[model samples]
Target chain A: MITLTLLLISLLNGGLAALIFFRGLKNKANFFFFLTLVATFFWIFGLGMFRMSSFENGIYWATLFYISASFCITYFLYFALFFDNKNIGKINFLNHLLIHSPNIITIIILLANFHFIKDYSLEPWGKSIKLGPAYFFYVTHIVSYMGYAIFAIIKRFRNVSGIEKTQLKFIVFGTITASIFALAFNLFLPFYTYQFVWIGPYSLIIMVVAITYAITKHHLMGIKTITSEILVGLLLSILFVNIFFNDNNLWFKIIIFLVAILIGYFLIRSVFKEVRQREHIEKLMKMRSEFLDIASHQLKTPISVIMGTASMFREGSIGKLPKEQQKKFVENIYRKSVKLSGIVRDILSASEFDTEKFSLPEGRLEPVDLEKLLIKIKDDSKEEADEKGLELNFIKTRAKISPIISDEFYLTQAIANIVDNAIKYTKAGRIDIMLDEDEKEVIVKVKDTGVGIPNEDKSRMFGKFERARNARDMYTDGSGLGLFISKEIIDAHSEASIKFNSEENKGTEFIITFQT
Target chain B: MAKILLIEDDNDQILLYHTVFKMNGFNIISAIDGKIGLDRAKNEHPDLIILDLNMEEMSGEEVIKRLKKNPETKNIPVIILTNMDKRKFQSQMLELGAEYFWEKTVVMPPDVVKKVRDFLEKNKIK
Candidate 1:
């Protein structure tokens, strides 16, 4: 029964070590933990064989077990040191040699058939599991390395939080518990009561379980992205193959295989889904900050214009001039204040539109005359056009026109937005507002002969807070939300769409068609 | 009197800055945009420039880059006079050979005239 138990423990260690070590091959910290697990499997296998062997060769097997134990302890120590990477300030080559000397010396002695074990006796346990001059050396080696690992882990735990703290806690508790069991079964029980030496190898399985749980459950390893699925998938496949060979019952093997494959598929899919979501969220965060920068940069100009002009009049920078001069400056300040208010209103509307909350309360649409609306829009923008030395034109294609059913306020703002944009962009030539009606649609066209939109900027002209590359150079006062708000209002009508055609350095023509 | 060429697009600002600088006993010749500013810089050969950051056909950055490249205007010192908050481009504008950065909204027009007067008195040509 003891031999059977030992083989099972050996197989468990081997399977876990193969999976993790395969996944951990590229990483230094994980590779050290893999070495520790591999050594534990070798120790358990050699000890199990020693129990079933004759007295003459049992000593050799016992020697092999001791050599493997030394290697296991050494590997666990190195694993603890390299685990967090932040704790390793300076890697001393000499200290490494000192820590490893015991393992190297023991393997050499065991190979030479030296006096670490002079001979063996076949008691019920069938081996002198812990008896040698170097026995004390092995004890000190395991105890000291475990002490060092505990110290390193505790030091690292204080500085970490979140998932790393949880992972390190598991590793620390597992290392301490495994060390105590090793001491009780191998050293204390064998000397004080002379039994339970066969049980020592089984306790090593606890350390293996703890490390494996950390890897699979907590994802303690920061894996390489875009290829993490392949590695984890390969590891699961190896585990399935191991189960295929180990189980004796054919029905049990097939049932377990199907269940594992089903669970594994979902696990990998969820991990991929989570990774992609995180990547997308990070991109949005970056864009949001950039949008804020542009918004603040654009909004500051109008605010400064209002404040600067107001103060210029207050300080009498224009001197004690005629009443006409003072009146013009006051009008300039009033105009700038209105522009600032417009910027703030557009910003609020754009933000509301972005969140999909901008809507008319209800039943706001009304019937309106198209000719009268176009005339109002042209009249409102005529003063602005004259101020810039540009002609504003309104052309009636027909003497009379049909009226369209629409939201009057939104319709007025939409047409006004198009005409305002035309005047703003046109520094020299005339801006013409032409009205034409077909059988099914009424179209309002705005054409400008100023600085036209660049081809690159035209595609994104209707995007919120988007402006042409050279638009700011032309006029620094625009908030970049006029065209976007116009687009939104037209879309809300559900019967109209705004389209534009432009050539760089020549002109642009915007056409708004409303379905009748 | 030091000839100061003020390049700005706003009408009110041009009238204000011209009145202030002229009263401070400096010769003030101004343009409304960057392209005209560059043309006048070469033709008039002013002793100093007051450049605005915003304009219609060309940017102030482009204007300064061309001014520094041209042999005729490379030696004159430039003072930036606009509503732009200077923290974003103060060091870079100085490196581009602008001698001072004055935010237009914060400083009084007379205060700006005083600063320009002090600068000219300190670095006046022999």
Candidate 2:
């Protein structure tokens, strides 16, 4: 009876190991599944050897059992490492070696027992039988291996997450129940009896519960439902044959095989259909964003022209008119044009960028002197800067020319935008443009003693259509496209990157770095 | 006084521009559309061409290309006066050899006249 039970347990363990090993191949990173397979294989081997008629030899049976205990402890250690997400190098290698060392030592000791006792005897109980240890060392090895597994489990319990935690709990309870049953059987029976012979099957039942949770919830070891469904369909077809044919014939088997093949083909087709539907939805979303961008770009050009011309008219550079009349006309144009222009530009730029079609054209790049460019830009902006009563200063750090190869017009436009933004935001403080060059890159820093960007707004400062909350509340007239355009131009330049550091109520500094 | 040809489509805008240029002592000749403007350029042989980009019959770009192709009118400098933003239109017009590019909103009529005067002075046209 003992031999029959051992044979059945070994076959069950081998089947479970094979299933886990197949699943492990799908997600190569799943070390947990691989470790489980290792544990199951060892248990199958040890039990199969012990139940063999040739292993009625006492020492051989003891060695196999000891090897099985060692593998169990190794499997628990693997579970701990998988959950922690810690570097494998960080796990103490010496501790792992120490844990597995006892199995080999136990096998050696059990072999030595052959000198003392040649054969083992089976003691009988109620409907089951237990093997007695002829060697003393075999008893010590079993106790030590169990103790090590319990210690590793306690150490790992705190680190696991979600379903793994529940699985660990079940495993611990099952192990304890098995250990208690073993103790009870040994105390009640005469001779050195194998305690808790029923514990092996009960432990497997607990593992199956954990495995079921892992498959349904965590998808552990990548054991997906598709494979299980196929297995179930095969089993159901077999059952149908037995019921319909009472006494089985060749014709019944052929009918079941043909139906199973048809079902399998449809299941594969449905999975492909689901994938195609998901791709179609993604494509529609992409097209919608592109349409919006094109519309915005089309609207922006005319609005900018209207605003720019109005500002020029208000300045009275065209002809001499009465002072009072000119002032009133200028003020009206400025107020209305600025507001409308800001809205149009912001919306358009945001939409264009979203569509991902706003790309800079490749231009001939040549070395440009930073100081000369700054002087020209300063001259151009002087009138507007003076009108606001704000001082715009260009402070040159180097006497020599700091040259960078980039698209001259676009680079000038980028720098001009930053300067314009500073003047617009600052009320009375100075705006400074500083140029410096290092060994490999040229740096242009635009510093302003203006209403600095607040911390909350800093994160979204470069985002499309986003303005600082304070700027919005103050009713500042800005399209909020200057920085966005500047960023795009700089990013397109092979040698340039733009960054800034700002503090609330203090000031903001924008730094542009270009590869020399 | 310089004999300037102004090609524009909008009635109100053309009236305003005509009045402003007339007041500045320019001999203003007008065309309501690109076809008439091209006809006037061939017959009158104006000293300068003031072109509007957004027109109903023919676009400013198309007009400029046609004028550049004609040997008789190729020497006459074209000035782009449009309601389109400077950043978008300026670079393209400049590359096409437009002597001046002005955004009508940011540039008043007076500034346009001054720019024309400067161009004439630089080229020694008068």
- The count of residue-pair clashes in candidate 2 stands at 11
lDDT of 1 by residue, A1-516 (tens): 787678667766765665565443666667887898898888888877777666787777777778888888889888878874634655689987887899888777767756565545555644564365766666777788877876776777787899778877767777778777877887657655435687777776677677667765775433433245445545555554455355477687677657765675566556656765776687768756766655675666555656665666677665576788778767777777766666676777778788884555358667788888888888877778998999899898977677777777767777787788888888798999999988888888999997899886898899766789778666764667789888888887757789999988798999999898
Residue pairs with clashing backbones, model 1: none
Cα displacement (angstroms), candidate 2, residue B62, comes to 64
Model 1, position A493: C-alpha lDDT score:
73
DockQ-derived CAPRI band for the predicted complex in model 2: incorrect
Which portion of correct inter-chain contacts appears in model 1?
A: 0.46
- Highest TM-score, which number? 1
In model 1, where do residues sit more than 4 Å from their true spots? A1-225, A228-290, A317-319, A387-389, A402-409, A450-459, A468-479, A503-506, B23-25, B69-71, B124-126
Candidate topping DockQ: 1
Error of 1 at B53 (Å): 1.9
Q: Could you give candidate 2's per-residue lDDT for residues A92-119 as a string of tens digits?
A: 7787677556655655554565332343
